[model samples]
Target: MTTVTARPRAGRDPMRLPVPRRVRLGLLVVHIVATAAWIGLDVALAVLVFVPMLDASWTAVCHQVLPLLFWPLLTTALLSLVSGTALGLVTRWGLVRHWWVAVKLVMNLLLVTLIVVLLGPGLADAGRHGRALAAGLPDVGEVPRLFMPPSVSITLLVLATVLSVWKPRGRVRKT
Candidate 1:
């Protein structure tokens, strides 16, 4: 005679059941939303604000172009970082397990630092002083090269995104 074995639940996997299903799903959704925000903000800032400022005239200095953009960029970066960190810590992507997450965290921190410490002030200053400096210059280029930092910052941000996605092999993983 054969005997039938009892099951734990109706539709649950008995083995390989570590983390709770709800927690896993919550983390996944949060990460997905955060990633989308980062990508969207990055693209919009690059194409809309920075690109136009490539040739912004002095008359357009106080046009609320770059100043209007800083908030969005800041918001996107902050949200993405916070949510991503939440996922990494709560889920299996913790620093010890997934080195990629660690690298991304570092990069995101660096980006934030640069913006807060360096770029944000500079942009504000440029917006404030640009009009006076460019007051009477008939030539277009006299407005000052405002586009330089934005270009660099935007490009670096894009690169950071790529690194997050590609997640190249880091030093810790080879061993």
Candidate 2:
């Protein structure tokens, strides 16, 4: 007796598990919401940073409130990263298969790393300075360049969003 087994279709890997349509949709929603939230946080931060420039008296208040956004910003960022990664893995675009997806992934990773390594500590220091300023203490030093972080993050995020909508590049060539 002989037995026959079905083979995967051409260009499809047998080991690659298929994701359900509903699950993919869910992931897409999560990714969109998280990305939007991250952008919103950056916008708020940008406003706060700008306020200090317009009115020096608001500096202490802005700095004090800026630190509070750290956790939420980090949370949204992480969510965006994870959802985007999962979407890439399960969807046809793949994590690194398509050029646009690959670029977005790299951007997300870089943003997340910057948030953890630079933004987090910077916000904490700002909070401390704000407290010192509020207490009328001398030698609080100058506030760090708060504009850079949000400005850079927003730019990269908007670029990523544009890439998602345009999907400009074709698939990366297999080496």
Candidate 3:
């Protein structure tokens, strides 16, 4: 059973919450840490994807290393998403209150969705190809496809980071 209260459209105190300050801070910390980790892993993946293009031997190393990273990156993405959403709900920054926050939310969701649906399978296939190449199997396909999403995602995450810090104006108007 739950009780519903009418929330004022414009005058609601964003900080009026059942959550404590430290808890909110903890969530923010976790969100930041996870986001940073996610970004770092993506950047590393981008580099690994490029390394083989420079030195053929790196292909074996990349394949051996990349598969091990899948779980950590996935965990970080999920943590950042959950913690960020919780922060938005609990703090003055309502989910859709400000344009930047809304954009961040949408972008983050897209990134996470891409990670789960597109990037995972693509990387797995890339790893398989890399392994085959390492074993002297001829004619592995272009590796660029494996790198594209993370490259784009890195750019997207950077934009999101900028939005978080800048927090430009333009709040959504209430009806």
Candidate 4:
């Protein structure tokens, strides 16, 4: 009778499973594209928020543009998270194995949460108040709430991208 080994074959690394090459490449491409899309969308939203400050005349147009961003941001955020998770799982970079991946995962999750809980509603409120402001009503206490979060999100995303590229040392040892 032939003996069977419980562990992975001698040539393969234990943490890095043998995923098909094409699948790995596809996942990486999707992850990268999604990340770019997410960052782009956030930056666009930031610009839109700034428009009203730059020109009071543009308030109505900004209000119109802001609502359109909601869906793209939501979609790209979800795709980045899912594709990144899959990449981590299928590659040598197990999700929590490396500090960078773990941090990115947490950051992305927080970003998603912020998008859902804070940013979306803030945008809607800002749009409503913007319309009112354009109509010559008092300001809507809008400066602090809407302007800051998108910048913070963009910063976090850029940080995550740096961590991904740098892949700094600090691996979580398995117990």
TM-scores for all predictions: 0.60, 0.92, 0.86, 0.87
lDDT of 2: 0.91
Candidate 4 TM-score over all chains jointly? 0.87
Candidate 3 ranges beyond 4 A from true positions:
1-16, 140-144
- Per-residue lDDT, model 3, residue 43, is 88
- TM accuracy, model 3: 0.86
lDDT of each: 0.60, 0.91, 0.83, 0.85
Q: Score residue 102 of candidate 1 by CA lDDT.
A: 68
Worst 10 residues of 1 by lDDT: 137-146
The alpha-carbon RMSD values of the candidates against the true structure, listed in the order shown, are 7.9, 2.1, 4.0, 2.5
lDDT of 1 by residue, 121-149 (tens): 65565455544445653433433345555
Model 4 C-alpha lDDT versus the unseen true structure? 0.85
Greater TM-score among 1 and 4 belongs to: 4
What's model 2's TM-score? 0.92
Tens-digit lDDT track of model 3 for 122-145 = 778777877787778885676536
- For 59-114, candidate 2 gives per-residue lDDT tens digits of 88898899999999999999999999999888778888889999999999999999
Order of models, best lDDT first: 2, 4, 3, 1
lDDT for model 3, please.
0.83
Off by over 4 Å in 1: 1-20, 47-63, 129-175
How high is the lDDT of residue 9 in model 2? 95
**Which pairs clash in the backbone of model 1?**
none
